[model samples]
Target chain A: MTQTNTIRVLVAKPGLDGHDRGAKVIARALRDAGMEVIYTGLRQTPEQIVEAAIQEDVDAIGLSILSGAHNFLFPKVVELLKKEGADDILVIGGGVIPDEDIPGLKEAGIAEIFTPGTPTSRIVEFIKENVKH
Target chain B: MDLIQSVLNGEKRGIAKMITLIEKNAPEAIEALKQIYQHTGKAAIIGITGPPGSGKSSLVNQLTKKIRSEDKKVGIIAIDPTSPFTGGALLGDRIRMQELALDQGVFIRSMGSRGALGGLSRASYDAAKVLDAAGMDYVIIETVGVGQSEIDIVKLADIVALVLIPGMGDEVQAIKAGVMEIGDVFVVNKADKDGANRVVTEIEMMLDLNTEKDAARPPVIKTIATTGEGIDELNEHIKKYWHQIANSNELAKRRKERIRSELISITEDHILNQILSDKSSKIDSMVKDIYEKKIDPYSAMELLIAPEK
Candidate 1:
């Protein structure tokens, strides 16, 4: 017999961004929504984030970058996950990313980028709907 | 068979997949774990447990680095608690172990206790076996911040290191009965802080009180995990303990006891699953009867068992 499955996600801050309020909020919100979230603390590199994701075997990686490094940081994580053959992990973004950067990020394999003021429920629903595993 | 073969071949992804399946209790997992069990008992299993903010993760990181210096593979199982209400957990142990993630020789997995008591998820036992079958030289299980009774680690780990930091007063009374006896090696981490020596003295006093005069007393070592101080000493102690136990029949005795308990638990789960199966007549209607007080839980359980027994 099988049991109800629990989805695991990784929440990370991949830059010199010191403030982690957004990441903590999403982690807590996901916990409230009944998902396990692995929180990699601040100042993690793209390589570190991706490695944690694979080791955690998470269904998704939620990257929060406020240092304006989404251009370099977010895509770098996605690329690393790909190189490791873990591209199936849903990659999403949040924080102060600009509208102009969202398209480039999507092209780079970020499924969605939630800018400021986006509701936590949207992130939860996006994960619930998009997580393949 | 391919997945089992991959695990035997030491592929990281395969081990990861096996652990995930085990975590979910997938139907294939029991069969897969049964095969994997043949390859276990080779790796050195160490369990570390202490109170919150006791530097367990940092100490584990240091110990891993030290072990890797010898060119051995290490598998880390770090546990955290799950919120009972939401069935969710924020597993932040990896936050202290980020640097070790990229080390191919090091495979670290975080687990939420999933409402398991005694500070570990039940699946951690199978996950440790997966790592062992994959040929890791060392398997380190770090428990969630533990209290007195969270000594279940002793059953799984060949040796248990109970890490304590300075500044928590009344330490002796805190772990007097529960974890105090379970620890094979006591570490006073964050020794740079004040009162480290006092904590050491307190532990020594407690150890001196142990009446097993023939047994080796667990050593109390001081460590600054952030700087990797005293980890070599701790590693040496762990190795020495292994050597001592290896030369005797103690290791086999411990393993036999461990497997016995594991068998009992797994069988109990299987029986319980059958009783709690999705058939509406089984649990759902019984739950309603219990709620309505038409039947008490104990009698309902007897009734449920009556038909089969």
Candidate 2:
């Protein structure tokens, strides 16, 4: 009855941000760390991201946005997941966002935020620790 | 039971959760498969396979849009390779099919091949069944960019379309003998690129070598998957193949063959798993016995398989 446990994470880019290098980096990092990562390439809407997360049945969704629209876009994805009754999917963010935005994003249900120069291992570790089964 | 009911109710969440569990081979999968198997065997499964960097994903996207225009519901299973070192995978096929992600009529799932060498994970076949039981009109599977011997898609799909792109290599290397022999339909994607016509000619030349005179030649269609060129014609060719097979009862024959292979495989897995994992059978002791040469491996297998006999 024992089956292998696989951690599935969706690495996505939301909004007008054309910057996807960060998302790709985290995706490759997560994969190299033994997690199945699905990368939805650039310019995904919150709705599309949520829909994909549901279909993929991923344990966590790491939303990477550098368009300075993180405040609006991050909460929108979290809200849509809640609306779809899939809020159990852990939502996290990473990018070039300023220091003032972390607390607000965290309050909006984002589990954590990784800013510039953070090692990819920390993000991978955070996903493994926070996945809700 | 509730998940089964929800899946039957066409709930996406339910279907997705069930597919994940079935892929993992959880205990509940057996009962669920029993309930769902009867609901399957109706949807057409089409496999789009080809070499790396080819336009298989884009073709799937366009074909899906074409099917959706007819008001048919579609389910897509796109498989990608897992890294051997980390047992992890990056399923990026969805990036090319982004337009279909939010469409209510389409359900797209990306799967990691999970060490299966035949271009598909075992979970992918089960996921296709989940989609079929959930009432999809067509299920489309896109295999990881394939090479020779990844032709496993041919055994499961009702129709197999082998896609090739120009400028990859000489025709001999590009047209792998293992895959070239099985395609029901052929595609020259990126037809707008240079050397497109040469690729077409090479396939035509290859097809002419077949000695099966009664079999109609599979059509070779040219396509530029990015700009949606020649997709309508490709879809028509696929439909024509389906119609021809259905009229000849070849569809039933293929399904019967598929079932025969699948049943044997499932039974083999079950017996081998039980034999190796059963502690009460003294599997560990048998290992020690073989190591000490007290029993040969073949005798050990016979003893494990039928102790009383």
Best by DockQ: 2
For candidate 2, lDDT tens digit of each residue in B1-309? Answer: 899988887789999999989877898887898898888987889999989889899999999999999899999999999998998999999999999998999999999999889888888878988999999988999999887778889767999999999987787864557877778899999999899999899899888888899887999999999999999999899889988998897899898998898899889988778766775557788889999999999998778888453
Q: Please, what are the lDDT tens digits per residue for candidate 1 over residues B1-309?
A: 999998998888888888999999888998998888889889999999999899999999999999999999999999999999999999998888877877989998999999898988989999999999999999999999987788889879999999999888776464478877888999999999999998999898888778898788999999999999999999999999999988899889899999899889878988777777734477788899899998999998787766664
Model 2 lDDT vs. the true structure?
A: 0.90
Candidate 2 stretches greater than 4 Å from native: B174-176, B279-283
Candidate 1 residue pairs in backbone clash:
none
Per-candidate TM vs. native? 0.94, 0.97
**Top candidate by TM-score:** 2
lDDT of 1 by residue, A90-124 (tens): 99999998898889999999999999899999999
Q: Model 2 chain B — which ten-residue stretch has the worst lDDT? A: B274-283
Shift in Å, residue A41, candidate 2: 0.5
lDDT for residue A75 in candidate 2, whole number 0-100: 95
Give the residue spans of candidate 1 off by over 4 A. B171-175, B278-303, B306-309
